[model samples]
Target: MRKYIIILISVIIIAFGGFYMKHQYDKKEAELQYFNQAKEKMENYLHENYKNIKEINFSDSYSINPMGGISVEGYLNGNKAKEFYGIYDKSNDEIGVSSVDAEEKSE
Candidate 1:
């Protein structure tokens, strides 16, 4: 009876280990696909703005998990978009011309 219990326990552990490894494999595959997609998107954006963009990044070391940092999206916090700081300066004045010219006057 003792030997049977030990065998059953070992079998359960092996089963759990296999399941855990499979889960990790699936997670890695998902991460790779996500990064590939993000890379394609970044390339598309850069190509669209090739004339305007100076530099660009496709991905970072941030994890795709919900309990992690920013990657494609900013954050999952239930906060609405808020303006950090903004100040506008506008100048309006009458147009003026310089008092100097290349044309010569008969003195």
Candidate 2:
């Protein structure tokens, strides 16, 4: 009985581990796809518009929980990549799209 239990437990562990890994892979794949699309759009917009192209805005991090009263999907503006975005409000932090701090560009 002990041997049988050990085998069963091992099988369960392997199954759960595979499921978790697959879940993680799917999540990462989705994020990568979203970033690719967003980057293309931003590049197109900058190339076509933004005459002089001083800066651009992108979203860095975001979340929306209606039940928790939490919302964060702010904006970012910058002339180059690796921008540092900070704000007074907590609900204003993005990663991929709104990572530009538009205010800084005006100056």
How does each model score on lDDT?
Answer: 0.41, 0.46
Model 2 Cα lDDT, one tens digit per residue, 40-74: 45545343433354444555553323422222222
User: How far is 8's C-alpha from truth in model 1 (Å)?
Assistant: 0.9
Residue pairs in candidate 1 whose N, alpha carbon or C atoms collide under 3 angstroms: none
Name the weakest run of 10 consecutive residues (lDDT summed) in model 1.
82-91
Over 4 Å off in model 1, which ranges?
Answer: 52-60, 65-107
Model 2 ranges off by over 4 Å: 52-107
- TM-scores for the candidates: 0.52, 0.51
- Total clashes, candidate 1? 0
Alpha-carbon shift of residue 66 in model 1 (angstroms)? 3.1
